[model samples]
Target: MLAVLEKVSFLLKMKVAQGFQTQIAGFYIYLGLMPSWSTRGL
Candidate 1:
């Protein structure tokens, strides 16, 4: 039971980390595109 719980926790942590990384990447991409968007009046 302990081993199963640990495995589940690890998987959950990995998923959370991946989601955080994706969010960070998206934020940077948005920031990088902002200048061009403003220039184009979008």
Candidate 2:
């Protein structure tokens, strides 16, 4: 039971970390893309 709980906790932490990384990557992509979009708009 303890092992299972530990596994669940580890997986949850991994998922949260993955989510944060994905958000940061997405933010950078948006930042990277926006300049081109604005340039096109002009």
Candidate 3:
């Protein structure tokens, strides 16, 4: 029972990490596009 609980917790941690990574990637993509958007607006 304890092992199963541990495994579940580990999987949860991994999912959280993956989510954080995706958010960071999205932020970087937004940052990369900002300059082009600004230039186009002008």
Give the best candidate by TM-score.
1
Question: Model 3, which residues run further than 4 Å from truth?
Answer: 36-42
Ranking by TM-score: 1, 3, 2
TM-score of each: 0.82, 0.76, 0.81
* Shift in Å, residue 11, candidate 2: 0.4
lDDT of 1 by residue, 1-42 (tens): 999999999999999999999999998898787887585774
Model 1 regions lying over 4 Å from their true place: 36-42
Report how far residue 28 has shifted in candidate 2, in Å.
0.3
Task: Report model 2's TM-score to 2 decimal places.
Answer: 0.76
Candidate 1 C-alpha RMSD relative to the actual structure: 3.6
* Candidate 2, residue 41: lDDT: 77
How much lDDT does each candidate structure score? Answer: 0.91, 0.91, 0.92
Query: What does candidate 3's lDDT look like per residue over 1-42, in tens digits?
Result: 999999999999999999999999998898787888685776
Please provide the root mean square deviation of candidate 2 (C-alpha atoms, Å).
4.1
Model 2, clash count? 0
**Clashes per candidate (backbone, < 3 Å):** 0, 0, 0
Write the residue-wise lDDT of candidate 2 on 1-42 in tens digits: 999999999999999999999999998898787878686775
